[model samples]
Target: MELIEVADAVQLGVERMGVGPPVLLIGGLGMPSQIWELSGLTAALVDAGFSVIAYNTRGVAPSTATEPPYSVDKLASDAEHLLEACGITEALVVGYSLGCYTAQCLVRRRPDMVTGAVFLAGLQPSPIGALVGQMELDLIGRLGEIPAQVRVFEQLMTTLSPAMLQDPETVSIWRQLLADGDSLWSDRKGLHGQLAASFEWIMNEEPHPEHLAQISAPVLVLAFEHDVFFPPRTSRETAQQIPNSQFKQIDGAAHGGLFSNETNVVETIAQFCADQRHRLDGGGSRYASP
Candidate 1:
């Protein structure tokens, strides 16, 4: 991993591999670039002949945190700068969960830089989601840091499919893996910063109509069948807001499908990107450079 300065004193750690059409991967809230590798998506994408660029977002280790009160728009700006620094004039962008909100902001803010986008475990504005963010911030303010075990339990309970939870072996494995958190999520302050930003964005800044419709790039919103946070209905609604966006639901998968249903998610993403490249070659839409 190399640290690239994206802004004044703000360096984002990035990993690049393979060579073909460039695909920028923006991870979820407090997610480090390494999760892509852990999910097997990075290697799969590399083997499938695409240049993969993944990075640890600001506030994550090796990346300058700067101050907090960050917004999704700010995260989107970081992504834009990262791409520009890499000399990628345009590329396919992929965002997972909170990363989906960032990707949406990026597509709208800088259409020229994004050829197409994929929102994995997509996000749509929800009163409930906003409320949850507020609740998290409130709890942090009142109780200090939430215990790691409690956080892990909440994560597993919310993200795993009901079927997966029912499987004792699967549940046990996940329990162990999550209990031993990775370096990427070790910074409590960074995670709280992200939580604050999410609360602010969802409550105040998320576009209602005109903003999403302004996005001109072809988009694919991939939804998981059992995602409590972003169910198919929510993902489809988000897709409806964006022009020319496609929504596909993955059966038997939950919010954590990116890992649990790795093969399907990887195949779907690879196919969508490949199709976009083909479209660009055929003098298709405005996906080509101006």
Candidate 2:
């Protein structure tokens, strides 16, 4: 793990693994790249023949601060530069939550640098999405702008299934992980700045539904059935907007379900990015967002 200087003030924290087709992973809000390894996703993707590149999203340590107007486009550019620094011109993208937003920005803003993508717990540019997302942000802030490790663990637990949270071992493991992760990216000021940028984008921006039609690359949208912030219905709507894109709503999860069921999620991603026909298989029936 090392920090790559993208510009004078824009050094990004990057972690690379495996030695095959490059796969860039962009994580969601408050998630450092460490979650990928902790969830076994890094190993799964590597075993499936992929060079996984996970980076700390802006506001996390080593990555420079978001100057002003922390737009999704800026995060996309940071991703592009991170890839370039690693000497990779193009790669498949896998994103979760806010990471999904960043992935969408990457494909639209720099299509030439992306091949295929998998967006999990994705958000649409709708009032509901914005509202839910805002609610999440507000809740987090109320918990404290720089949350305690236990608070982080508690917050994440709320977004997972009861079955997952019921396991004491699982809780202990993730609690330690939360503690470990805080050490890496717990710069409160930077985090607040990133959230500020996210707020701006959510309020001022509209969903780019038209851009979906123009995207030539294949895409797979994975939505958690119980995700309140970004529901499966929205992912279904997003998939329809993109020609030939696949959509699936897996059971046994909520917003943070992917990590809770890492094995299933990793396999889903591997198959999708590999162009397998069954990539779109094994999901719940759909429901429209209310």
Candidate 3:
């Protein structure tokens, strides 16, 4: 674990493992960087022979928080600075959920720093998601504050698939996880900022749908089979827009598939990175953003 100074003297909590080709892992809205480890993706990636870099987004614990109503572009800038600070010229960027918005903006703004990108369980716009974001914002404004337990329950219901919630054993495990609670759920300011960013991204404020065509790096749009937010249809549309992109869906998984199907997710990502490396080694040239 290391503290990386990005912009505005804000220090981001970053973790790195392995010493192979670099792979930057960005989590979803308010997602702790430790999820990479808890899901076993980081260790699996290390075994696959790739340097893995993961970090807590600003406003999360160990990382300084700024004002609320954060924008996706600002988040992307932080990621750019992190790469610069680490002296990594190029890497395979992977973003999940809200992090997908950040990755999109990063690739568009700084193509030279990205070898390829993976949008895991996200990148596609969701009308339902936009509505949900607005409701959350309104609830925050009207109620002042929501109970932490309520928030946790809300997340569990929305994040996991109906199938997962139905299984008694799975629900039992999730109950324990909910009991432990997440730092993001307790941080009012950070939670608000993340919600604002999520809303903005869903509304297409930062990297709008048209911006997808401008991306120059090879992209993999990985969608969970049961992801209600970024469904496979929307994900396919998102992939078609990218000049160089592929779309794949994991079976029997939802938005929370990163945790529910960690092994499969890791295998898919490892294969994508391996293929990208082969392409680069074969003198594949990426297109420049217009």
Tell me how many clashing residue pairs each candidate has: 0, 0, 0
Residue 22 lDDT, candidate 2, scale 0-100: 74
User: lDDT per residue, candidate 2, 51-106, as tens digits?
Assistant: 78899887788676655336677778888878777877668899887788789888
Pairs in steric clash, model 1: none
- How displaced is residue 129 in candidate 2, in Å? 5.4
Q: 1-290, model 1: which lDDT tens digit per residue?
A: 89998888788988988877788999887777888998888887788767789998888887777666677888899999988888777788999988888888888788887889998885675566676677677777888666677768877886688888999998899988777653564366667777777787777747567888888889998998877777788778878988888989998887789887533888888888887875433232222111
Model 1 scores worst on lDDT over the 10 consecutive residues at 281-290
Candidate 3 pairs with clashing backbones: none
Give all TM-scores, in the order shown. Answer: 0.91, 0.81, 0.91
lDDT of each candidate versus the true structure: 0.79, 0.71, 0.80
Worst 10 residues of 3 by lDDT: 281-290
Quote the positional error of residue 197 for candidate 2 in Å.
3.4
Candidate 3 — which residues are off by over 4 angstroms?
205-207, 278-290
